[model samples]
Target: MAKLIVSKFGGTSMGDAECMLRSSEVAFGRGASLVVVSATSGTTNDLIALGKASESQPWAEAEKILSKIHSRHVKIAADLHLPTESMQRLETLFEEMGSIAKGINLLKDCSVKAMDTLMSLGERMSSVLCTEAMAQVLKRHNSDKKAMWFDVREVLRTDDSFGKARPLTKEVESLSQKKLGFLRDYKTVVVTQGYIGSTEEGMTTTLGRGGSDYSAAILAEGVAADVLEIWTDVAGIATTDPRICPAAKPIDEISFKEASELATFGAKVLHPATLLPAIRKNIPVFVGSSFDADAKGTWIRKEVEDHPLIRAMAMRKKQILVTLSTPEMLHAHGFLFQIFKIFNDHKVSIDAITTSEISVSVTLDDSTLVNKKLIADLSEIADVQVEENLTLISLIGNNINHTPGLAKQIFETISDINVRMICLGASKHNFCFLVSEDQSTQAIQRLHKKFVEA
Candidate 1:
């Protein structure tokens, strides 16, 4: 029996009619029973812009955005020559989206919940187009299989977290077995939307930005799939971002731990949370290009043949370092707890942290700096000094902490660069530090040349 495969195509792979058709061919060739798709390229951003304009801008401006979105999808539908029923389905979705935007405009409020509903339209629309494309492919090949669209929100249950909803794994697993287990029949190719789920109360919620990959992994785990394939524009996972280092090579295989670290530190190909479900179920993931399906892609699994000390490095920019100093923290038990509690209450996740006798410094996404209340709360407990325009450079590999002279070699490679807030010993797979944003590229180049290229 063939393995049960769940394949997900990224936005670029679903950018246009031709792209969707190509991705459908790849999915069919790979024997993927379940196909997941993101919105066409730039559609999500346009949706976001439409929501903002509806809330604050004139109705004319918001309608213009809505028209742009409609035109783009209409062209795709026209190119595909979808039947009247399919076109009417898309028309209904468009009308629903326009109604939501008009409601937001009248209320002059775009709540996170409302924004999730708006953003979800992107995936919902693309899934319809992709299902039509898959049907055409099946017909072209004269296959007996049928193509159908599955509403993921029915099974992908999540909390009402709005913009960044969390999936209830057990509930998703139970629902998947009940609703999606039939996919094993290999008779119907089910195309579903990624990145959006529904709360128990039936309100729509999104799994955050770049969450379609996570959505694929969740569904893969839900059905106990043998493989999860992520089809994007890029050929495969490289030693580094190829745009940054032309000499970077594609990694044929990587372990789950290394891939997780690489993603958390800022690899754009995979979302940070994408691997959690796959890892839990020990499902192997394939990252390949939908445009060039024949290329040898990267495979992420539990173990690989080689475990390099420094496999790959990733850099995340726009980081803010917050240093909290209070003499009360010196040998104080609850003081540290209080500081963490405040951050937890604010829902700001810390990336890297270091503590001294009286001071604790943590790295956060620069976006969190907008929360004045979080900063004010921390200021009440300690003298808070926030440093902006920092970058986090992470080295992902195996035995990074156990290996001797690794840090020395790393520092020696970039001896001239100023390194701040070193985080190590916590994970054997990651060694991360902070540097000025302006110097990050130079740091990564020098480090990559020394570690990866060498």
Candidate 2:
């Protein structure tokens, strides 16, 4: 039996008519029975802007943004020469979007729930166009395979989180087996939208930014696919971000643990949560460029031949360090729990953390710091200091905590830099530290040269 492959293409891969055609060809050539695609390039951001404008701007202004969005999809549809049915579907979606914008403008309110519904139009429209593209590719190949557009919301069930919903895994698995199991016959190519799912109450919800990959992984696991392919703009995973370190090289293969650490730390190729399902099911994942399908892509698996001490390094910028200090924390067991519970209540995730008897310091994404209520809650128990303009740098590899002299070598390389916080021993795959944002580039370059290049 042929290996079952579920392929996901990023925004740029579906940017325009040509991009969609190329991505369709890649999917077909790779024998992807199910293809998951993101919104066209920049469409999600445009929808977000439309949502904000609808809430604050004049009706005319919101209309203009909506017109722009409509024109984008119309042009792609025209280029692909989509069927009348598909074009009508696109028009109906645009009508719904316009109505939503009008309502939000009149109400002067764009709740997270409304924003999710508005943003979901991006993927919904792209899936229509991509389905036509897939049909054209199948016709061109003169194959008997039928191309079908599948509504992922039919199978991908999530909680009612609206803006960042979590998938209901068991439901997804059962639904996939019942609804998508026909793909096992190898006679149909199913095109589906990613990043968007329906709540148990049937309300539309999104999986947050860069969630397309995560959704694809979830579906792959649900169907028990043999492989998951993530096709993006880049060729594959690199030793380091090429824009930051020009000397960065491509990684042909990587272990799931190291890839997870790299993504959590800041590698943009894969979303931090994308590998979770794949890891649980031990499914191999492929990361490659849809623009250059022939390129050697990176493969992520449970094990690899090489287990280097330092595989790759990542840098996450615009981090905020929150330090909570109080005499109450000294020899206290529940104090840390209280601090963490406050963050949990606010739904803010802490990245790297270090603690002392009297003080606990943690790193968080700069965006999450906008919740003043969280700070206020913490301030009631301890003195809280928020430090911005910080960057978290992580080294992802094997046995990071077990390797002696690793920290010494790293510090020796960047002895001049002031390390604000250090988090280690938590995971053997990662050793992360914080530094000033301005010195992040220099620090990463030096470390890459000393460790990766050498």
Writing each residue's lDDT as its tens digit, candidate 1 over 70-130 gives: 9999999999998888898899999989999999999999999999999999999999998
Give model 1's clash tally.
0
Off by over 4 Å in 1: none
Q: lDDT of each prediction vs. the true structure?
A: 0.95, 0.95
lDDT at position 399, candidate 1: 92
* TM-score for candidate 2: 0.99
Error of 1 at 398 (Å): 1.0
Q: Which residues of candidate 2, in runs, are more than 4 Å off?
A: none
lDDT of 1 at 413: 89
Report the lDDT tens digits of candidate 2 across residue range 1-454. Answer: 7989999999999999999999999999999999999999999999999999999998888888888999899999999998999999999999989988988998999999999999999999999999999999999999899999999999999999889999999999999999999988999999999999998788999999999999999999999999999999999999899999999999999999999999999999999999999999999999999999999999999989999999999999999999999998887789989998999999999899998989999999998777889989999999999999999999999998999999999999999999999999999999999999999999999999999999
